[model samples]
Target chain A: MRHFVFSLFTLLLACGAQAELRVFATVPEWAALARELGGDRVKVYSATSAFQDPHRIEAKPSLLAQARQANLVVAAGAELEVGWLPLVLRDSGNAAIQPGRPGYFEAAACVDRLEVPSVVDRAHGDVHAAGNPHIHLDPHRVQKVAEALAARLAEVDAPNAATYQANLKAFSGKWQAAIARWEREGAPLKGVGVLVHHASFTYLTHWLGMKELGTLEPKPGIEPTSGQLSGLLARQQAAPARMVLRTAYNPEGPSQWIAGKSGTPAVLLPYTVGGTPAAKDLVGLFDDTLQRLLQAVR
Target chain B: MQKRIAMAAMLAATFGAQAADHSELAAIRAQIDDMKRAYEQRIAALEQKLAQAESRPAAKPAPATVQSERTDSRRPAAGPASGFNPEVSLILQGQYKNMKDVPERGITGFWPAGGHDHGEGAIEGISKRGFSVDHTELVLAANIDPYWRGQAIIAAIDGTAEVEEAWFQSLGLGHGIGLKGGRFRSGIGYLNEQHPHMWDFADAPLMYRALFGNHGSYTNDGVQLKWLAPTDTFIELGAEMGRGANFPGTDRNKNGSGAAAVFAHVGGEVGVSNSWRAGVSYLTTQAKSRAAHFAGTVDDEVEGLFDGRSQNFIADLVWKWAPNGNPKYQNFKFQTEYFQRREKGDLTCATPEGAAATVACDGMLSAYRTRQSGWYAQGVYQFTPNWRAGLRYEQLDSGRRDFGDNAAYLVVDSYRPKKASAMIDYSWSEFSRVRLQYAQDKSMFGITDNQVTVQYIMSLGAHGAHKF
Candidate 1:
């Protein structure tokens, strides 16, 4: 039948289109990094986005669909996506991207890691002591992820290895320059004190020699209760901490409460790109984040 | 750590006093013990790092300071279970309305055609209300270990507030067998097990609301068992004996009848492709009839015997398609479900024409039969991370019935009428929804009622399980 022939033709076209390597990333930052390295040859998507709280994303039907179609799945492992991604992948039956599979990419794997906690206690909050999952905020580590992704893309798409290599080189050069500029900008801010949620920005804070006073969350991923907030307020009133830092997605209520109870400014920073207009991309994300922190501290 | 150990000892003492009755909190403590072990391992790792750094040469003093600072950074604001998390969420929305026939309907008015009648005919003053807490709910969930998980839910509206789900789950059983018991939602169906906290819509679907009753067949006094098969598939079988719904103000010792229900469900998903499931359920009970005493506008109080039964079967399938790495956005998601039901027996008395009967069925008995089926297809597409749209079309029909073929019979008008309904809804974000839907219904059996409703939904809470 003519319909059957048309269907076969469409199927053939789809098969041909599938030649472009498919790569899945758990968040936009990693997806962006993969795209920069793989260029036109790889299709990338994130399990969560700049606007979403990576900690509490729901594994909905649509997300499962993406997991099903993925050829290579990337995520900020170390328990960042532990809440739902595991269920999604296990239910998706995507053996290709199952944990420990070659197609499975844990972006944190490449880092000379920090935040490797010696203790694992949930009494404070759910802990992913493997390492801090938020590493892309550090330019040097982000470059490492880019290099790994390029190598992986080359292995999957050998014909486009040269293109991926060139892309990685360009990305590294640009990243190196940006890091130098940030270092220079951060020269005078060493040991500057601040408070935040968990160790979400440990790499960035450590890079700038920012002395962390404490965290707003009594525990990782837990909200600041009234009693805890009051305690922090008491501490803030006494010590006059330079700044209170928070991600864009964190509830404004706790931050607002701390600000009202204590004469302190809560610096709402863009935790990822596209979270705010000022944080349009990786470079803009850091630039805007550092600028906001600098302004608050000053 | 000492405080925790003392508390654990005190809890163990309390549990020893009440040996038989399982204390949910005690089980949670055991689970926390496991998490404590994991935390201790991390602590050991950090201690080793610190020891190594401290033992290093004087030339590496800078590195040691950095290492100490990094260790300090890993510490959380909360000491242990203190001020660790405070969850909050917000939702605001509105409802637009247009009612046919009556310009105004109160909460107690008789329902127009194609609407569900709860305890009475639809009431008055219900149509014009703009927006309210349609889907706002709060959740605090914690897992102590493999054998215990604790959860609490609070809604903006409904009956007196009480703990909705408080139970302990056991996973260290034979062959992946798990046990659950306590005040929990009966795992009667795919949707029922998925608490209202997990629904995509502000209101449940019409078929579910109709047959199962609004609030969807929630009852107390139950136990459940789940078996995970080797192929990564799971089967759940459960039962419960609880107080039935009929006369609102009856005591458990009086005309209350024992109701028995049974159900089984199995399903799983593969890759990013699709998920499928099938289920069957049956429930039956005896009904007690009574005559009017103080309010004798009707017939004499008659003691009668009646049996009621209901059976349901369902098949469902879901498919999601998105290319790898792009999870923030999905091109499409598809879900479809088919359900069927059978019911028999009735308790109704004859009434004269042109006259409404407040009391008519004295020692009068009637028989009735019901056959129904329906299906629905729903999909959602995320245009961007902050925005998404959804569409759903649901259809249900209760076939025509036959009573005594006499006008005097109670439910005479509804003895042979069919009921059909359909709803379409769209939702935005994880917290809000706006819905518009229509239905056509006919049933004097008190089982047939229909009406159109424009509903709005809003939610506040930590993330709930997804519909995938």
Candidate 2:
């Protein structure tokens, strides 16, 4: 019995040593970013798929199992995961990735957020007091988060610090070049008035200089009513938007209805990595988004 | 700067060509305003980044040095003003129940367990014939420190308040070990740990009512220890020691623990949509002089007292499925649990002091023993975002009863008990729900009750996520 116990302990230690860093990301975009920074030195897992709403994901047992062995947990914090992340962290029983620890990294904390509400009230529907958490759409904010994530990786897995830094440098250089090209190619999209299904596209429109006409839903998380849809239609007929924008996961009914009534195009943009077939990575996400928007305008 | 000046020059040339178009001019002005706001935001972001960088430590240190610094700075020096303020939430619940007015209610084929009974005008356990307040709970939770987290749930039934749960859990216990102490719901079965508000139906299963009395759950003051295995699949083992002061056990004034329990659970996901968990548990306790009231065959009330050892074995399973791992619109969950109990002890049955004894007790103590078992199965489906429907069926068997030498006075029944319930609930938001439930309850051997209940539950403060 003693020998068996000793062998079991040794086996657990060997398993722990195999993975230099186990990263659990609450969203796919963060998982993609972690993979880019920790190349070969880290094992990354995404708790939610690109086709799932981040705000409403359940704290399933599968996620808890992943969190139990994770050396780092990446989340779009600022209350984006307020509903489920706390429960996952509390129940994981893994001390390494609890809040305020070195292993826990929040992407939104690394950048300035938009749409911060001064008066926090549910009367305005489900409003995040810490501002909009869709910071990944802005490539600049993604770059900022990359720097912080790289630093965090180095802190947790010091043996791979040099590798992490080198990977960060290479990723940043390529990403900056891609951003420049996208900006130049997307100049035609400047000052284009668009209607969005939700405020999820706030950072994206802000980056590309698109004007947001209105939202389909009257509030942040409330479903759109027929009365509200007709109101938006009336406003659209008076000052027509060029297109209606929605993510791949959003319900297509409202956007299609408005687009049909206004005689405009309804565009589906890939909100994250793997959201669409062409959006297989970070660069492809923006490329596909720009391509879809350009197609709509043409 | 040069690009802006050139754009302004181009706009001026356009204006010179189409000066008569007022709508075009207004649109150009709006575009210019948008550009101005965008630039201002960009500058502000850059300034904020600069400030952050300036505030960071200047020296680039090695990883070892950084680790030491982080260890030293485990707790934040300055917390938010409301950091000490706990997350407080209140659940408001009321229900209108329509059923027969049975003055005294008890499941027929089961031994009467001891727990909280209804307060005031509640003649039929938790509900009456008309409108009544259900269990309204006020919960407060917060991280006590770097090493501990604490929570308290106070429940108000009718006009009286009771502490439902108050516990502190260790937050920094590594290696998948967790420690908790205080009064808490026993983690014996899947449904036992969840509060009534989280139940899919308005009422609990008949099996629970038989085992833990009308309260439908077992709570005790105890210390619990749990260990989670480090594996891809979820495996957890837990053990608890508690003061056995509630149903199926009695408060035997002793120095050590009177009740002990151990449980193990295994779970995993199948493909991308379905997940399942299965668990088995065992509990043992000692009861000294437990009191119970039962109706005799002649409608006379009989008093029974028991002193003995009781043991329970339970098995539970839950399975859930959502399309593409997204449950925003549709999902389904099926859960089932089975409970078997065995008890051996000396039982004394007699009439109350003021009542006449239809059956003579003769002051005789009989060596009585019994083995009983119960099981329930339920399923809930959410077809839309705001609507859900559920159905549950439960049955109990009074397997064997032996009242040696006192069989005439302590009568045993051969009848089995069962109930079937169906419910539909709609939620306008995550914090509010209204449910309509109907049940055909035959748990009380001779009576088959058709019951209807309409319940409304509203949460007034902090929103809590339900555990899977």
Docking class of 2: incorrect
Candidate 1: interface RMSD in Å?
11.0
Report fnat for all candidates as fractions from 0 to 1: 0.04, 0.34
Interface RMSD of candidate 2, in Å, is: 7.9
Worst 10 residues of 1 chain B by lDDT: B105-114
The two-chain DockQ for each candidate, comma-separated, is 0.05, 0.19
State which candidate has the highest TM-score: 2
Question: What are the RMSDs of all candidates, in order?
Answer: 14.1, 14.9
Please give the distance, in angstroms, between residue B399's alpha carbon in candidate 1 and its true position after superposition: 6.7
Candidate 2 chain B, which ten residues in sequence have the lowest lDDT sum?
B58-67
lDDT of 1 by residue, B1-468 (tens): 999999999999888867744566678787898898677656656654653334211112222222222222112211222233633333333355443343222111111221223223332223333333343445665444533445555544344454555665542343434466665665555566565534544345545554454554344444555544433354445555444442111114644344555676565445533444555655554333311111122332222223345455555555555433233444455666666666556544433222344445544667645566666666666554334456666655555444332114332122333334344455444445556644444422334334565666565433434544
Clashes, model 2: 0
Model 1 docking tier (incorrect/acceptable/medium/high): incorrect
What TM-score results for chain B when candidate 2 is compared with the true chain B?
Answer: 0.81
- Deviating ranges (above 4 Å) for candidate 1: A1-19, A116-119, A260-263, B1-369, B372-468
